[model samples]
Target: MNAVTELLAGWMPGQRWFGGKGREWADVTAEGFLLDQSDPVLSVHRVRVTYKDGATETYLVPLSWRESPVEELSSAFIGAVADPHGGENYAYDAMRDRDATVPWLTHLVAASTVGPMRFHPAGVAYIPEGLPGDILSTEQSNTSLVYGETAILKLFRRLEPGLNPDVEVHDALRQTENPHIAPLLGYVEIDNGPGEEASTVAMLQAFVPNASDGWRLATSSVRDLYAEGDLHADEVGGDFAGESERLGEATASVHRDLTRVLPTEPAERDWYRSLAEQMTSRLEAALAVVPDLAEHADGLRRLYAAVADTDEPVVRQRVHGDLHLGQVLRTASGWIVLDFEGEPARPLAARRELDTPLRDVAGMLRSFDYAARHMLVEQPGDPQRSYRAQEWAERNRQAFWAGYSAASDLQLSAGSALLRAFEADKAVYECVYEARNRPHWLMIPLSSLSRLTSLV
Candidate 1:
């Protein structure tokens, strides 16, 4: 048991599947496990642990413990040889184990194919008929194991309480016939406890595959547009007008469905205003480092304050709370929205709050800048070519706004100022995001902020 604990504790810290930040492993307490017929060879252990980064939680780590620690095994674990008294163990990432993951995913699908939920070492798995099958990236908020072409099993990580909104909203919208989102194919609905009051700990739904994430596709478009020659922007195949309109239409359709099936109320003026204020503060805080932005700060502030104060048809209802180019997928059929789960950085309660539809629109519009600017720097050329690329980005940015506004109910009316305000606010937030993680990409939002007052 002690050898098992040491090997697992070291292995877990380096795993993408492990939830905790694995700076240093600590307090590796073995809570429980399912020992297989092959001793520790095929085993699942439940360990409660605290890390050097000050996080404490319980996690399930499956190990391929060996009778003789072999260096020939996978790098995910270190091999431990037998010492005098007992068996020595080595470490390895359980997910990399073919015997473990492949079997685990298969067992999960079989369990989901049956009556209800199945709890195996692989986590909660779900199955629906006719959906595409694949395993989603482990870096995300949940572990998704798709069963065929009809169903998706999402096993939650960083587990939360109650019915997860990703499952609930999609299911409700499916029942209401909403087309903007991927429809649900039922769920596993694990309670984690025997009582009915316990929250759903797992989910299964319709699988969406063969779709290019909008972010990547959009960046490709921007790259083509930002190429060294003026011919780049003129190329309709590279231009983004068609997709922008389709995406806008999708957003509008989603909003219309919300209006019909979901609840809406008067918009919260103070909240929008405060959020705008925060955007301003963040911009100021970041602008201090950029220095080139100080000239435009006052202008941005006035525009932001004005837009935040608009009192028009402010309706609040369910929305794709964390919409962005990254959140959408372009399919052969059309665009498919993925993951109703809100911003993972935000708390569940805050994510569930009803906000203006423009909030979503703003997230997407901000992504336009990211798409355009990210590629602008990628394309190296002479001064004239660089200027041409900047021009291309500008042209596409306008086209995107026009396409979205045409699909939406937004206008230049006094009440509709919130739309523009929110767009700027979104860009301001982007500046912070880019600064902390992608400093070279700061120009994207800076250019966007410069145009804050230009949008009618």
Candidate 2:
């Protein structure tokens, strides 16, 4: 390993966006191209890693080179390296370096091609050039920068062979003028080679200013309910049922637009069996990681069996693959959905596949459970608080379903076999994720499983 690769191998694993954590690296290699050669040089490198298991992955690493490090950028500094010109130079993560972020907007405005990267603007919105962007701290798999208040740029950390679903879905929805979607302003792509599709490197979208995320709003409502000892969820001043209903309507509208512009097909009997098998396979894999899941294994198998045995008519269409409270925003006008990339851990091909919209609905339902019960994680053995949390979750879930049914003309009761199976599958997925990421929070999904397995 050279100086840059060695620096990356040490720094990359500590980053929140790095996905290859816990894996043993057999080899590491990197290649770079200069994006800007001004005072503070900016360069983007593609770092490829070969793991011991023979699996390989590539990551996008943008570094800003400076003659001397500034005091303010001490935290973002990667390390010092020998310059080809014979002097030592400092390197820092470009996304967090304000001086290095200007070239991204300038390139998009000019539609320039730098090395293998191409910047394509949508030509619908004005590009905010000359503005230095600030990196958002809450992102996980991808790093995002807010260009003033006009636009937000999301850089895909992992490299894949095709267009990202976020950019693809947003481009498709542009013609619909869907009020619930944040408009796509532009995107960056890289040439993969002959006979291979171009890969999306980054995407730019209109920023929603003065908007509170759905998770924050929902949790605030839960806090309000908890404060009012005797008051019900609906009676509280911060009741979120109305907002939940509006969010449901917004989701249904997006789903309708997606179906109109994208592909849709009716599910065959074989599809049901295949879905059941997929869910069962995931459960078996999860059981190996989460031993606590063994208790729910029999009940989960029974749930998957119901999914296979049911003859419910279904139509699969392009829907939000990952829907949760954090993925939405509550602006003054209405609710706006964000991040169509689906689960970042899943393969790009699988994320693009059409599926039942109920999967999204189930995801939101599970989020409601999360928002209500998350507070109980810090305060256990409180029956009164637990009852209030369950009450809040049930009330909002019903309201969301009512709004969805009214908008789509698709009424799904809590007992709908398909809905139940989707929810159970989601909970099982949550159990595995919490076990791996947040062990203390595992009980939230485990508690939901108790209720799901008890259903007739």
Best by lDDT: 2
lDDT by residue for model 2 (1-456), tens: 789989888999999999999999999999889999996999999999999999999899999999987899999999999988898999999999999999999999999999999999999998899999999999799999998899999999999999999999999999999999999999999887799988899999999999999999999999999999999998999999999999889999999899889999988989899999999999999999999988888998998988898877788888899999999999999999999999999999999998988999999999999999999999878999999999999999998887787787454565787887888899999998899899999989999988888773
Residue 165 displacement (Å), model 1: 2.6
Best by TM-score: 2
lDDT of each: 0.62, 0.93
For candidate 1, write residues 109-203 as lDDT tens digits: 44432222343222222443333335556446556665666566665554444566676677667656656677664444333455543334455
Please report, as a residue range, the 10-residue window in candidate 2 with the lowest summed lDDT.
Answer: 405-414
The segments of candidate 2 whose C-alpha lies over 4 angstroms from its true place after superposition are 409-413
State model 1's lDDT: 0.62
List RMSD in Å for every model shown.
5.3, 1.2
